[model samples]
Target: MSRVRTLEEIPLRKFHWQMFFYTGGGAFIDGYIIGIIAVALAVLQPQFDMSLTLVGMIAMATYVGMFFGGIIGGYLTDIIGRKTMFLLDLGLFVLASIPQFFVTDPAQLIIWRFILGFAVGADNPISATYMAEFAPSKQRGVLLGGLIALWYVGYGASYLVGYWLLALGDDSWRWMLTSSAIPAIILLFARLKMPESPLWLASKGKVKEANAIIQKIFGKGVILSESFEYKEKTSFMDIFKNGYGKWTLFIALFWTLQVAPAFAIATYIPQVLGEFGFADGNMEYLGSAIMSLFYLVGLLPAIYLVDKIGRRPVLIWPFLVSSVVLVVLGITSSWQMSFALTITLFVIYGIFNTSMNIHQWIYPNELFPTKIRGTAVGFGTGVSRIGASLSTFLFPLILSKYGLEVTMYCCAALFFVGFLISFMMAPETRNMTLAETSTLNKPSIKFSSKPSPKRETV
Candidate 1:
């Protein structure tokens, strides 16, 4: 009896872009909400008489919400289905942002951001798995990389928007925080038409429905080989016992370390630049926008290289280079370089840090089966947010007390640990079908000597 063709065997088409833009919409909003806060905090903290610690807490709040949202959403997507979480999460995000425009105090802003963060957190795995499952294996890296690249674009966009919105005067922070709702609103309508992932359908044994979707995608009737079969049930423990648990762990741990430095530094870009004479609300937002632009630029080359060089090499080398960049940026900044030179140095730093970060963002969903992809990705992402939150919470105080040089050096050292993890431990799965990489085709630990001779699949 013939089954449906596996999702990877299907050709790419306009439907994929629909999925790309639909899912990317939420990601764009998440990045915007996360990015605009740097300037928003700069605007609001002094207006409200917030201490440095309160500033950190306010900054840390959204990440804290995202941490749990990822963990919960990850599990729910697997149990419920991808489409449900896709719409519901973005709705929650929109609902959370509505109150931000009305907030009068620090605690109110923090609470709203946390709720918004949870909704943003929930979108991560749902979008990652949705795109990975639907993408053709050969171009999977570019597609997933594209999904992540737009996030940086969103980050850059937020700063750009915040810069102009400063015309709202002190109230720009209100507009900046609330503006994330716009994209989330658009995604809800666009995403409603999206079908369940064919892989997710097949996982539930809805073979006819799964085949129907693939037919729409491939524009012809297709057969599902036995390779498409996936048990309806999944467990968190399964990720650990299966070879995939290691991929889960690497994705989580590396993301945690990578994020510790990225978000912590990005949060205070305005403050950091102020030392170089880029003060005032408008100029601060402009400098912050420029800082974010390099991250977006860094993602450009990855669109070409991630599929060509393979994930491990692309992931490893950029991380190593970014680590060096961080250390040198630290050393240079300590000496008080010319203002023009200082901004240029940080711009270079943004390129490498963002390139490596995009690679890290795409890893987890690509390495697991649909049955557990959401959970595994969520588990890793949730843990990483905690690390990110801690850094956000602590970075302000650390920088204030110890100076910029110490913080920069410490961030560089953390990224070096990320390099070690990617270089020494991360597996090469580029160009392989998810089943082949996840080893669902053969039930054995991949790290064991002589992993059951490689088995190719549709």
Candidate 2:
């Protein structure tokens, strides 16, 4: 009799690609939801007669919702199962998205945007967990990174949509905000066929159910690996105990430092461009659209290098290069700021900063065990959004009061601090199995708890 193949040993198949497309669809919509609003807010500010503070509140509200959604949705994902939460969140996205077309006041708009953001937040950890649990260890980086790449694609697409729609007269922002519903509805229906994660199922001791899924999807030749037998009681607190506390802290820190500036800058790139010289509204929106391409270029190299050279190098080196770029831009903010020089610096920063951002999806999922992966990811997402929310809210206030030089300097400092922390703490998980890379195998690694001899596998 032939030995049954493990999920790790199987070659990439049609199922994997289809799964990524279906699972990754949420990310595309997430990109559109956030990205469209960057330009939409430009119109919203003047039309709504919003104060700078009110504009900031409207901008910050989605992330505030993200903060709550990540925590609540993440816990529920682990408890109720990835498949259930997967469809439900997108439904929320649809319901929240349609109301944007009808809001009569700033408060009503903020409420709808917050609800849309909640859906996006819940989908973040859920999609990452689903992809990671099913992906071959060798290709996990690309699969996870591709999910983020889709986010940029969605973001970039939104810019294109917003740029064109800006020509549609004063009410264009409504259409831009409501457009997210199209993708959200499509993904909700598409994902209904996706199976529950086999690894998650195996971890729950549903071996028969898991094996049926394995054979059904991966073929009759594949079976549950021996590693799946290990089982233990899981708690929400597990992510904070057993040496996980340090990882939890590291993920939250790096995630926050990376996103706070990125989100702030992306959210207000038009205004930043205005300061630099592209003061025309059309020109500013056009420039922001072009900047999206630079980010996509940066992500391509990272997807290749992540599994090639290892995670530590991919995470560590980009932080250094991106930080240096920001420092240069900050120092030059006092100069005349020629278009060529300004665009060059912005392009370089966008590329490298976006490159490093891929790890936000990769790290938290890799660092924790299957049992607590959702909770850990949720915690990281929620904490990072707190920073993002504050930065988005405060960015305009600071820009108005302190000028671009001060704002650039502050962001530079944050990126440099991130470089230092990542250098000291980033772990290498290049070729290791999920069970091996997580706390399940390495007990002696400082603050971690000892793993039991029992193991779980898919």
Candidate 3:
């Protein structure tokens, strides 16, 4: 007789890779949509004769929409199911994206951008949860890490596309804004054939249905993980109970610290590079595109290190190094160093800063249980955007008023604070099953396939 394997123990298979591609596809759209706006804002400012405040409003609009989307979409994913929200958001992505090409005013553009941001926000939690629930424990880090990796790839592609589109005359920003729909449509159709998360099904006490999916997708030999047998009603409030609140706080803060500076900087990278004398009409966009490449390159090492050295170290060290790099970059800018030297410093900062991208998708899903995983991830996503939105809105204004040195110094301080927090709060989830990581305080717990009414302590 053959040994039976749990879903968490299954070896690498084609279907697993397919899932990775499909889920990570949403991440690509998220990155492209977010990054392309940086380029669009440059054109929009000159075209519309917009004030600085209005420019900031247009830049920060998506993040504002994300704030609400993260909270609502996450709760809905937990209540309704992952696959439902997963598809719905992509549909929204397609519908909301097309209108940008036709917008005659900032208000129209902001409304559509907000809807697009909402879709990205909703997809963030759902995609992470779906990937986590199915991935084998040994490959989980790399798999989740790949999702973030794809995000950078998409981010980089946006700049490349934006740079290329600059040649299409003054109306190129319209095309750049509308370009995201292509991938969103592709991913939407690709995901249609994918099934619901079996772990989610098992959590809802649909064992037969869950098993059928497992057998169909992963072969008849694989079984659902025993932990999912403990069916419990998931409530948004559950994220705050059973010692999970600390994790909720930590994940939210860490994500915020990472993205606030990163997003703000990336959103205005062209302008920032211009400050250092790279200000030629399209030269800054080209520089921004190259810097985006370093962001993708940075993720390559982290994909391996995340599983090898443990999540805690991977989370903690990058914050320290990136903080120092930003400070150096600030001083270099103050000294009016050669453009090459400044660019080298910016590249270094970009690489080290990107190490945290992996954790953005990894930590939220790993830290919470199936019952409220979406809600927890969504809460983190929503909260993080608040900081990202504010910083992105303020970045250009600050850069104009305080100069590049102060902006870099302020960002460095934020990075240093992140280092301290992660050093204190980051957990090591290496080689641990979802069951182990979710209930960090109760490592010895197990579950039977039999139904239960009591709430699981995750």
Candidate 4:
């Protein structure tokens, strides 16, 4: 049999594109789903007589489903295999999304949305882990960053189509929601023929099988490393037992702090613009689509610099910029702000917030090893969803009671706090291999034997 191999040692090849495209498709689905809400809520609020509370809940429903879905998917992907959950989650997305078009009531739509969220939750961990594990070590950050960048592309696509459909009159929301299913369908067929993760196979002691797969990736004559050893099963507690616990803490604090504000802004961009008097015609949708482009553009520098510079600097500096500009934007909100001024600040904030947020996608995959990578990613991503769900649910309430300035101020606060955490705690993960990261020391953490809460860690 050919010698066994480590994932990092493999040569980067054209084959990586298949994995990237497949996973990127899933990321696109996530973006399209989140972005569709901009138009869906606008149409629904008038059509269904949607109260702010109901509107919040309808949006919250998907996050709620995703929270559990990410957690459950972690276990399933880790225990079963990457390819199974990889393909399966896309199928669930298709099934759940299709029902959205036919819903006559909020309750029905909520159920379908929840189901769709669950699929999104599952897809996040599985896709992120797959990309990290298979990528050449030097290119890992770039590969992972690009995977998330596709989310912005997907978000942009939703706006282009949503605005066009919105002009179609009453059935606009249905087409907007249903159109997301097309990408998921395309992803499903693409992923069906993809290979299993070799790192995961090695973790299961399938050395011979892993090598055979690597041959296809690195060409037939290559010899491989045999250093990896496998355990038959994973202990959920192990992820928390060592320094891994601190990494888990970072993911929770870092991801939630970013997502709560980022998503809230994205979800309500059209409405926020409406409040600023861009209310009539497709200008709001058109403006929303234009702004989405900045987020995608923001990802370009991050894709180039995330590995080149370092994760902490890229992550922290952007948050500082995002937070400071947010304060300026908030103060200007009451200064009789001109539309040009407001859009300018939002453009700057959008770029920084999106670029900084790429770290969340890159870190979870880098922090854990093959054995627990899925579970860890799923759990950490799930925790972040709690913050996302809460912020989305509470956004309207906060916006209504406190108005735009306070809402922007609160968003600024979250980013500022995240900046401190990242500056103090974000490890230099940019150029490190997954194995190197898994063994890196923590900055200083308080640990206890009190098996952490189920929701807190794996």
Best by lDDT: 3
Model 4 spans with C-alpha error above 4 angstroms? 1-6, 221-226, 442-458
Least accurate 10 contiguous residues by lDDT in model 3: 449-458
- What ranges in model 1 sit over 4 Å off? 1-5, 440-458
Of 2 and 4, the candidate ahead on lDDT is 2
Can you write out model 3's per-residue Cα lDDT over 242-360, one digit (the tens) per residue?
87998999998899999999899999999898888878767788888888988777788888899887788888888988889988878877566776677778788888888777998
The TM-score between candidate 4 and the true structure equals 0.93
lDDT of 2 by residue, 176-288 (tens): 99999999888888998999988778777777898899988877877665565445555889888887888999999999999898899999998888887787648888888
Candidate 4, residues 46-125, lDDT tens digits: the string is 89988999999989888888889888998788888999998889889888888889999889988998998899898888
lDDT of 1 at 425: 78
Task: In candidate 4, list every pair of residues with a backbone clash.
Answer: none
lDDT of each: 0.79, 0.85, 0.87, 0.82
TM-score of each: 0.93, 0.95, 0.95, 0.93
**What number of backbone clashes does candidate 1 have, counting pairs of residues 3 or more apart or in separate chains?**
6
Of the pair 2 and 4, which is ahead by TM-score? Answer: 2
**C-alpha lDDT of candidate 3 relative to the true structure:** 0.87
| Stretch of 10 with least lDDT, candidate 2 | 447-456
Single out the weakest 10-residue window by summed lDDT for candidate 1. 446-455
